[model samples]
Target: MNVTLEQARALDALARQGTFAAAAKALHKGHTAVLYALRTLEEQTELVLLDRRGYRTRLTPAGERVLEHCRKLLEAERELEAACAEIRAGWEPTLRIIFDGIFPAEPLLRVVKQLRAEGAGTRFHVSAEFLAGVEAAFTRDEADLMVSVLPPTLPDLRSYRLADLKAVLVAHRSHPLATQRGPLKDEELARHLLLTVRGSDPRLQLSTGALEGRSTVHLNDFAAKKAAILEGLGYGWLPEHLMKRELRRGELKALKLASGATHLFHPSLHHRAGVRLGRAASRVVQALTGVELPTPP
Candidate 1:
């Protein structure tokens, strides 16, 4: 094929920017240059790439398929650049991390601030998952590092214990369950609505701190779960660190269950075994482990 990376890039930019003029501005090239690149690409491929049938510029069917491949090519180019940088310097161009919802944010923020202050040039992509969701992210290779309450038992994975997070079953002061004076029975607790975090895996539909066969309110994230509980919607377990203020102010009351009221979740830092981690990933692991920070590169 006579296609070049520049032609693919120009096509991708044009598709993203909608018009040749906008694409030219985005690529820092003249309008004629942008048009020429796309025109050359179509001629080489023997396909009409753009449809001018409507007022708005749209990609033809073949154009859409070619654009999709071009996007993949662009992504590969970026990865190539990052790989080159890693060979020259011991630093990664990007680091992706996934944290379970129960993991504390304060410490993570502090660590990120320190990384930034140290002039770490690595780009960060952070996301939050819950329960089995963390394991799913790791399994799918979505993140370079993961902080999870339940570490998957995969042969290719390695884990390091970071910290134990404490969780307590709590309810708003005005809730019916909160009025009970002593340890709650399973049946009594199960009678009320339970707010729980929904797992991402459709096959599993797993949950923590939730009773089966009970009326339940399922929220996608911890923040929403906390909000639902605060509104007296239901009682559910929350990370102690997240609700300490509410617990202290008596806005929420921790329940004592006959079985157990508190649970300790051991969160661990996990990564793929036998894979060399970049400098930024190494530093993040140290931060999570409470080890002394390494000298800045």
Candidate 2:
């Protein structure tokens, strides 16, 4: 009931690092200090926090629940500090960006490096989502800016064209479809398993680049989808940028559709309408908008 923030932080650190010594090292404090804080917290709360019987320290059931709350408290404290610092420096305290999985990673990384190089003080949090997942992140107020492919139209949202990505249907070389001659028919494509990225929306499951009525395997992320394709588990559309090495190495073969078609995915940057962007966010937007990625050959 009267626990201090330091005590709460020690509990969180101890839960994460699994031992007082490791937690102390992470917190840049003496081991005894970490122990003292956690013990003080336990005494104040009248709860047994650490189970010290095993080789590795662990949280008791009550400790686990208490630590969960501590984590939230710590997160809020961090945000508060960041906000104060940003206000003092005339910058936005934090910027949250969610990028679609299909978007090229190299350019994003470059932009981040450039931001750091400029000594920008804005705290950045970035995450990757696929398909409707990107839009969902935005709608949930989880991000301040989003880069997405075919983002759903929403009221009070503004969008700008960021870049286009080339996507091609592909499968592992060992897959039977890879041996088929000429453009593959829809029926032929449907017979094979389709690896699709799962959407984040709980109310409505969504998919892109998937043939209707096809046998499918849904994966959580692009990396998992690519891995499934590499394992010959299924064929699916992949960003050309991500599969270049695999294609060059003959590990994956592009599937020629009946129309001999490849898709150009237009990814756009989005932000809430009427929301003023912080200096760092604006710079990031400018850098990304100006970036010119090489067209897939």
Candidate 3:
């Protein structure tokens, strides 16, 4: 038996409104039309979908199951209509953004939340990568935009300086290096493990703040590296922003290095040169450049 979307819609309205007249009012249709649609749906499915015996109509057990499926169809139709409207309004259907994991995601996510509320209907696929992995993913996926510390030397690349990420060399308070008063020497640091995040793209060789001939452990992301460092596993560089609570609690201490304890990473927003950005991408760039960005929660 073939069931129509119109029939599904009628059943949905009837289930929601709880009465035929109420359902008709909600659908902007006559009471008779609503009744006919429900009747046809029941006949087509060979199921007693509605229990009309009640003072106010209610769906039978089978009707509830059918309603669940009908709701999905209605939701899909709504999404399709929304997508079409977005396309007509010159919003890109999808935007892929690859950013360095070291960069804070709150600002970008806050901007996205604002854009979504403003009816900028671009679907976003955001990925956080480490160092060279950001550029690698951006090039491999031909992503719409990227936020990276390693700006690729491509001919048609456009980049805008977003923010400087201050990275501090840190270790757990209980670690041997934490007790050292003076600037940590090369030999002192080399004696412990260096917790570092491995780039997503293994083929591209990259490292940050690593010493030669040091005992090392590669991790997947900064979160894992942070966990390892907090467990007194090793010492490595961490974003200063991420260390605020730990530093305040005396759980993690910044190392005073002979070379330097802190370094600045200039992560920038990059896109293809000469390519005009859609509304969503433009908003992202604007927000990243400190234009009316919401305060971090």
Candidate 4:
């Protein structure tokens, strides 16, 4: 109570982000201003908050205590504001969701629409990227919330399970091997050209030795892989959601590789581990899924 909330917040921002410049930008001030404020705060409290070494920043024992108090105070303040808003004017305020290309647009869009219908005045900014693009974006702290194929968890990152996507082999109906359906045997593929995503994950499923006699084409991402197939290059496995239009329009047809031979890829919602999620992310979590990822205690 000796220190103002602004001082506590500055300390929290630096501790959570691990960089002075980043914390400064987030607090809407210059790096020098943050430095000056923290210096003043520490002088007033007569305690060290940050253990700074060259460009690296870390919280000291005292700083850690300050951050804990800061988070509690901030959460209380936010809850108070939300209570007043809920009683006075109904709204979620803001939301930014970064998603993978595989999750499909319609379903996620529908979720956002449903939230609005519930009187949640949420503004949604949906960023759709290919698998790796979205993953990279999340890692870079560019997205508030993420929906992507599960990757190895990164430090200071938490995830929630969303749904599963089934991938299947696809081809133009006029292809020679189009008639051979119902859990395709690898033997049958030797006669048809093959298109697959270029990566260790995709390669693990598609072996070079297995495709020895087959004509193979590897592309950067799903969009490119789908494009290669559209040009009649080769048959490629695609996400169930991406091929909905083609499946319905007879432009592309899905072939079952094997009965119950499903690849159950998980789509998960992810957010920064320690940093608290903002209003938009919270609303999306509550509205779309009845789940909220707990922040570090």
Candidate 5:
């Protein structure tokens, strides 16, 4: 049966002080209200709680057992309440962050270090995945934050542009495409095998060299795509950050199209705005990027 604070306190006070009037005084109640609390507790438990001998009241054997249980429970609740109060007065226990595959990992590591320096005592449990995969995490309550390339459709998610990146087509310097026409002409590009992300489809054919009839290889795995290009398997396009070091060494070179344009990757930070993310999740967004992320209601 359920026991209220007043019932437990009234019983404890009466046992400790030995009188109904004094127990009611200890509970800051009228003698009748204290009597009512005790009565309700007794009814719920189906146990006789007090023995009244004229104006004197004492605990029965059953009341004594109930009193022991009540005292322990009440003391434990009080300790929990005190601990919760301390938590509210100080800081959160931990923070969960979700980062996309494209979000610069090093920058996030720096942010974590900075947070530690500020004495937040906040620990971040990060779940990182591709932007598409990150959306799944939000839906399943697996991630508190999501950083990804902005999806054209996200009806229930909120996002803010956090950073920009450049996407470029690159190939091993030894590739046949790299040896093609000096000006890197359209006709020459069409003659070589093309590699691209499967989802982008050939419609994202950024290069006229990537004409409709060209031989092509579509890949979804990033590591495989990179390994293929490095082994002189084919010409491929990738986000610049992923190939930054190789590009620096001239092992790979950017493909320049007739239009002289390079692709840009814009990273968006997303969370289930106005609803899903807890307070610490929101705070981390503000604290890290100085941007207020939105939420769903």
Candidate 6:
């Protein structure tokens, strides 16, 4: 009940560093001080937090549970400090953004580079998620911005469309289907393997251009899918921007499919409607959407 931040920090360091000496070095404290902090923590909490019986000190099961809560406390403290820094600096401490994996990364990197050149102080955490995973990550992380293919379904959301991404069904130049002239028949497509990206969200049955009865191999990202296709392992849809050089050089050939050779995926940038944008986030929005947003007051 009376545990202090010092005690929690010592426990965390011990768990991470694995030994009293290491933990002490990490905390910039003497070994005795680190031991005392952890002992006091155990006394105050009435829990045997560490098991020192073995040659190596380890946390008891109870210690692990307490450490979890302690980690949350430490994280909240860090967030509080960041918030204060943001207030003084007039930039968000960090901007968390999640974008669809199908969307090209070059554009995002260009925006980030521009922001860095302009002396934006906000730190960036960017991730690419597939299908419903994009929205799930945005909500779970309370992300400041998201680029997603899913349309905004919530009333509290604001969205603007970016350029549509083009996905082309492709096969390796040496694959049997690559030589076929006319639109590929369903029966022929069925015989060949379809390389597809597995959705980042595990709970959802999300996929694109997967034929009903074809044999398929699921990969984690477009890069892997492209690799597999180029290796002649299978044929699948890949983002056009990703394989232009390969297509032009005959390393990969776009499949002429009966259903469709090309698929257009529309992605939009979204943020919470009522929340004011920080300077960095606003600049990023302008870079992506070409519409300047007002910075938070």
| Per-prediction TM-score | 0.66, 0.65, 0.73, 0.53, 0.56, 0.68
**lDDT, candidate 6, 1-297, per-residue tens:** 876789889999999999999999999999999999999999988999999998779999999999998998899889888668766766887899999899998888888888888776688999998888788899899999999876755578889999988878889999999999998887788888887677322232223334634587889999988889988998887889999999899899988866678877788999999988888888889999999877677
Q: In model 2, which regions exceed 4 Å deviation?
A: 1-86, 199-210, 291-297
RMSD of each: 10.4, 12.4, 5.6, 15.7, 8.7, 10.8
1 against 6, candidate with superior lDDT: 6
CA-RMSD of model 3: 5.6
Give the Å error, residue 98, model 1.
Answer: 0.9
Shift in Å, residue 74, candidate 2: 20
Which 10 consecutive residues of model 2 have the lowest summed lDDT? 199-208
State the lDDT of candidate 1 residue by residue for 1-297, as single tens digits.
777788988998888889888989999999999889999999989999999888768999999999999888889899887667654676777788888888987766777788878776677877888878777886686578888877576678867898688888899999999999888877788889888788223332233234644577779888998999999999888889999999999999988777677877788888887777877788888878855434445
lDDT of 4 by residue, 111-198 (tens): 7777668766556778776656677776675667888785744677777777678876677776655666566777777667787654
| TM-score-better candidate, 1 vs 6 | 6
Ranking by lDDT: 6, 3, 1, 2, 4, 5
Q: What is the full ranking by TM-score, best candidate first?
A: 3, 6, 1, 2, 5, 4
Question: Candidate 6 local accuracy as lDDT?
Answer: 0.85
> Clash pairs of candidate 3?
none
Q: How many residue-pair clashes does candidate 1 contain?
A: 0
**Predicted structure with the largest TM-score when compared to the true one:** 3
- The CA root-mean-square deviation of candidate 5, after full C-alpha superposition on the true structure, stands at 8.7
Q: Provide the overall lDDT of each model, using Cα atoms, as 2-decimal numbers.
A: 0.80, 0.79, 0.83, 0.70, 0.70, 0.85
Between prediction 1 and prediction 2, which has the larger lDDT? 1
lDDT of 2: 0.79
